[model samples]
Target: MLEKVYPPFIFNEFDRKNKFGLFMDVEKVIYSGVTKFQRIDIFETKAFGKVFTLDGVPMTCELDEFVYHEMISHVPLFLHENPKKVLVIGGGDGGTVREVLKHPSIEKVIMCELDEEVVEATKKYLPNLSYELNNPKVHLVFEDGSKFIKNFNNEFDVIIIDSTDPTEGGGGALYTESFYQDCFKALTENGVFTAQTEEPFIEKEWMIRAYKRISSVFNVAKLYLGFVPEYTPGTWSWTFASKNIDPIKDFNPEKVRNFDKELKYYNEEMHVASFALPNFVKKMIKDI
Candidate 1:
């Protein structure tokens, strides 16, 4: 055991000092190693099933990975008029790629992940989530996405950033204002973008700062709420940004019918409801 360290992604201060933190009881460690980029740990737990963590933070688990993976993939894809090409940055677990492939209209997905090691680990221990990584439409590129997005101009229809904590090794770059500007310029005119911002209950400032960055670059930006059971925070957050499309006004509900039942956490109803923020949450990002 590394002792009960608060995973930094949850927030920098969630420890004995704050007297508040969450812990997942691990029964066994499935795989533990250090990638060149960051530490990787995959553990088995009675409650969360097989879990994956980066550094000391939990990334996803078998029990509830679908909630986040589904929300992140569907909302943006459905929001775009006809999302044929997509770019996913840092979703090495392949969960986001799996959900993106469900839409038949998707012609290609360029997965720009920094660490090939994390992709290999997830594919080996979390096969169900990683199975689609090898699909014909998915291209695996091992590099920094922040740099990769800059090379393209008006290319992808949707861009999803499923990255780790900003404080993790090399992760802070993804949250910067310049990085969002790169993403903003890499998309087609009607493109939609979404990123896993984090849980507002504990990471309100981080969440708002990220939302503000995206809001500055996009013609339209909205903050939506979702829940990841393994994340411990009561409500998780995702930011929806578009070049010219408003997530709600331009939402394509009819497109959801093609893949509705196959999805576990998202549907037409939740698509709209996710954007309806709680009063407290609204107060946090209201100024931005």
Candidate 2:
């Protein structure tokens, strides 16, 4: 009998203490190197298409990215009556920008990314996500996100923080209370602000802390869930904060129903359902 061998699997150490992690079969490495801020890896996986990872953590992939990008952009967009100017912070891959461009009413989108190399890598290897980054209405700014918003007040209609996990590399400052205050000051009167809050199933304390901080800054703060298979535990959360708009009570489903773009994961019903939290998640954010 002949012995069989398989390619090695790549494991992401999401929970180091418990030794819990997720693995993907890497087909090929498109690009791998240490950028100025963090380690960037672009690889083709058997399960998902080309994936972008920072510091050994899965960020986004071609397969299930629409679920995350659409939910993050469209939820607050539809809730707000007319969103003209948009700002995206730390989404170097351009997935969030692509989704933001779907709304016809948007006049401009400014994407502020900390690392220029990440944008270069995405533009080279991940064209599907990065193609829209060059659109006429999109402006790419390579700078620190925490400091970028300080220059603006009553500017953007919607601000999306499509950043990596807070503890990973330099993204920790993005989740701070002061940064949330800056985001609150940067938005217009009816502006909506949102960020990718960590998965509660794996990082409960982080989620609670983020929720408390955001709640304290914004007049109305709420947490929503989305299913991103690439993320640990197959679940992800996003924090939505607004100066005046109520995400649920003020949400207009007709705006979403009238959206011309073809969406994959997010829909009118899912928009409402996404806000309905499970018992544990409700309990987690209740006292925070």
Candidate 3:
């Protein structure tokens, strides 16, 4: 049975010093347990509907997930001319895969998640997000993503690293230089790669390190911003690295205009705007 929590559940972030708590009008703990990788909790609140937390940190919620999922999936995808084969690392919730499948150009999507428990819990508690995991075009693989991608060479046209934070219980090796090198090797020529880089306000050093490492491996490295309300400060960033494609210069505006799928957050103008980073972030990654 899942552990139950009452109203006024506190959702902590960074440290106990910075946190966001909500006193829900209605609340129910759908599932809670310690998975092999980390502690998992799925709960429903009046404000966010269904919320998924890992290691006591709120990862994603139903209300504002579209902003994060759309930005992360579409930015690199539309940048690539024909993203037929794609790999998603650590998106067990299936939101990334859901967004990726919206592109008719995508033929196969392999979602390599480290923990199957996260997949199961989300599938039961958050059906809307995890429904795409069963799609014929989607292949679910349970393995350490960093190790899984190393076996491939020039195989995927786009790689999306929807990993957790790189803190103590968060994704450790997934943020390392070695993993970026493996990602570089796994992507084909003209392939584009993007990862969920930490928020600059709270994770400045971590973001800088990721930017530098990705820049060292790929010819074109860029950073883009998204408004994920569930995350701290309401602003989150994604890092893009490409072997040969420049995300902005190589973007297909026609594809965006003619896209058949219904989109909530990302569009052609938003694509161009996402790349326009603040001066502080610009200076941070400028040297790299």
Off by over 4 Å in 2: 1-7, 13-18, 168-171
In model 2, what lDDT does residue 264 have?
Answer: 94
The predictions' CA RMSDs to the true structure, in order, are 3.1, 3.9, 2.5
Residues 1-288, model 2: lDDT tens digits:
101111345555554543786677888878887877888887788888887888667789988988889988888888778889999999999999998898888999999999999999999988888899999999999998999989999898999998887764434888889999999999999999889888888777888888889999999999999998888788889989999899889988888888788999888899889999999999998976
Which residue pairs collide, candidate 3? none
Give lDDT tens digits, candidate 3, residues 110-219.
Answer: 99999999999988888889999999999999999989998999999999999988875444888988999999999999899999888788657788888888888889
Distance from true position, residue 160, model 1, in Å? 0.4
Error of 1 at 233 (Å): 1.4
What tens digits encode model 1's per-residue C-alpha lDDT throughout 87-202?
99999999999999988889999999999999999989999999999999999999988888889998889999998867633348899999999998898988889998877887
Answer with 1 or 2, whichever has the higher lDDT: 2
